[model samples]
Target: MSAPPSGPSLPKPESITASLLLGAMFNWALWGVLGCQTYLYHIYFPNDKAAFKYLIYGVFLFETAQTALNTHDTYIWFSRGFGDFLNFTKVLTSPLNTPMMGAVIALVVQLFYAHRIWTLRKSWLWFCMLLVGITLAQTGGAFYGGIRAFQAGSFVKAQTDPSNRRAVYVWLIGEAVADVLIAAAMVYLMILRRGQSHRFRSHGILARVVTITVESNCATASLAILSLIMFAGIPDTNYFTCPTIVIGKVYANTLLVSFNNRIVLRNLSQIGSPSFSSGSNIVTSSRLPLQKSTPSSAGRAFESDTITYTVHRFTETDSTTEKMDHELQETSAMKGSPSHHV
Candidate 1:
């Protein structure tokens, strides 16, 4: 019988870098998708508010920066450092790309959704505030973890330290919790709450909204949970980075897709009504116009609390408004509108 060597143990080269390399490749792939979405958003919603435009472009730029930094670090590890185990051990720029930038992007997206929740239901102000707190806490944890990892100087040290690991736990767990809450809030506010309305349920439009909200948020939350599992289960390897690095991309793409989906929604709205003129106004709001109207030349404008959108022209009649129930008037639809809380 012999005791195993007790000195610092290193993983096989294949295991050590394979996950990281694959993660970086996925990160770039998602970045490409984000770029295309950003361009499409610019073209499709030219009249979108300046603040909205700035947010979309800002996230794109942050993702671009992350991809660039990841590429530089990858080159250092595989090109310049080729065959050198020491080079592979260093933290390099990974902290910047993975937790640092990723956390900031997630925070922005979460807060954006939170604002939407507030806009939809003023009474849910407390819920929105709670979401903001969770998002901010996760971002703080991520930044703290990134700093700790960088200070550790090496993956081995970062994993071995309890404080560093705790920080990571906070970041990932908080992210998952925030994502789930956001999804649930959107579903409840935008879809389920409207279930009582006969028109919405009958048309099945609310069903589609529910699907989109759940699927998008589920994707991000699942990844965060998976990353947490990998980090906890296999502490010695970089397996967790595979999912962690792409989390930001997932968040960015989800937001962009929600924005772009408005095009589809616009088409959906026009399905039954063909009288809408050529020009379209993409309005960001919680209410979608579903109330029936009569024949008139002038178009109808769907207004919301947050952003004003000059929607397509449709006929109007007095009976449509007079016949409407007070509840229906108060509770608007979510069709052909910007995501309620994407």
Candidate 2:
């Protein structure tokens, strides 16, 4: 009789090594992008109120450190002696360790975002809560399950138990749900805000800043959702299987970094232009007549007529006639003034 069919092969060692390398590369590149974006945003907008920008920068730093650690671990796993490598994995994946710390940080950031959304007085509050809740649920589930598995020694357990597999399933499902919710909320918010363009009264710097904030958040949320979805299909075995997990992680990080960079660039471009408050004309009406010169012979007569000239001030009316008159007068004055004096 033919020998019994062999069971499905465990993931190959080579695959694991490749995955780890890729993951490390991905994280490094992602952080690099984040750093660049942060630099650009700060240089361009220089907004003291944007405390979250620093938080984002901190995230990039943490990711960079994590990437370095992961790279070391991957090297140990693939190139160092087997005993030494196994020891390294144990230390790195220990229940009470840096990986766990990183996971906690991630959760904290999500909660912070939720709090911000809760402060909004309109439908945004509900929308933000839903997105935040879904994200937290997924992230929390994965984190808790992973910790449990690590505690039970199932993370590296030789005999794959159904319980261990189930834990992974829960984590995956949670991540997927979170991704979908975040994506849906982002798209909805974008649509809602698009309708409010007509309500924007301010122009120049203020308007540009507001536009950037809205666009960046929407883009970041959308990218995050897309990355999460891409991660949903990753096999449970590949969680620590190396190359596959690494690839997915890299892609997600890159997307986030790219979105941030785009926002920063757009914001910077707006900052270089003449600000609306400084450049726009103000409309003011006066009953005073123009000053006329007296004739040398003292026989010339002149009639007094009301003349209106627009002044540059902080406030101006929205009347079309007033705006047209202001522009025409300004143009005429410019042409009549001596070029050297002006």
Candidate 3:
């Protein structure tokens, strides 16, 4: 194990000022976004699974707490100036907001996706189980690393030890693996579902659904990969942290979008054209409760159902009933009865 030098010191030499500023800004912006997205999800997708709702609420609340903690730390660092911003021991971010929490959030999101996969394709159980195992592995490693790192309170020391480095490495690499597996599995499930169901194939509903899935997971997975690479490549610098800080939020918010986008996908399918041109155009949504879409020019299927009428013929209709009704003006309607006086 490597030990840090004696006596406390400030982080003037390290250029982590940008990291702190950027991380804070990203956290704040994502939190604002998360609020709006949560509102829309509840309002529009009210019929989502109860478990899913609880998961969202849990994440929302937990992340809200995290946001508060992060903000408070930033405030103390900037306003109070009691400790150096770069000095891990002087700063008090640990035990409050750790990457382990992020790991848990990411794990929950993975489990959500795993459930989705199970529902989509039971045959994919083994794969989903693998993902769940990976999630747990990462969570364990991250929790250990975060607690240790926080306690050690020294970035230099944290990276110097093989065990410390191994813990974080396991956590980050596991997270990246989870991302890749989940995304690819989801895409595969969607494609398989459409192929199995002919109706879905003709309407291209699943096509759009696949497109959305790919779009949503692609950004997140790319970030995960990038973060993992940076963490691996540049273990000492704060560069890896730039992505690590916001990645959990990204995972949570992305899961939120994926959950809520189900309703959007259903609505879009109902109003979609029959013909679909995939990859040629993009369906964009603004960052808000409502994301507008430009109508696709694909050909639409117009179903016209015809109702047939039945006609009955009577024999000797004219001869049997020459006059169905007779006028009663003469008051001699019956052959043997006379009409009563009014």
Q: RMSD for each model, in Å, please?
A: 10.1, 12.8, 20.4
What is candidate 3's CA lDDT for residue 12? 49
Q: Which stretches of candidate 3 lie over 4 Å from their true place?
A: 1-14, 82-91, 200-203, 271-342
lDDT of 3 at 203: 33
Which has the greatest lDDT? 1
RMSD to native, candidate 3? 20.4
- Clash pairs (backbone) in predicted model 3: none
Residue range 8-75, candidate 3, lDDT tens digits: 65454344455655777898898888888899777865655676678888888888888888788667
lDDT of 1 by residue, 9-117 (tens): 6678876788779988999899999999999898878767778888899999989989999899889988999989878788898888999899998998888778867
Q: Give the alpha carbon lDDT tens digit for every residue of 35-58 in model 2.
A: 666566456434433454565555
Backbone collisions counted per model: 2, 2, 0
Per-residue lDDT of 64 in model 1 = 90
TM-score, model 3 to reference: 0.71
Task: Rate residue 91 of model 3 by lDDT.
Answer: 30
Name the regions of candidate 1 deviating beyond 4 angstroms.
Answer: 1-9, 190-192, 200-205, 274-342
lDDT of the candidates, in the order given: 0.77, 0.43, 0.63
Arrange candidates by TM-score, descending. Answer: 1, 3, 2
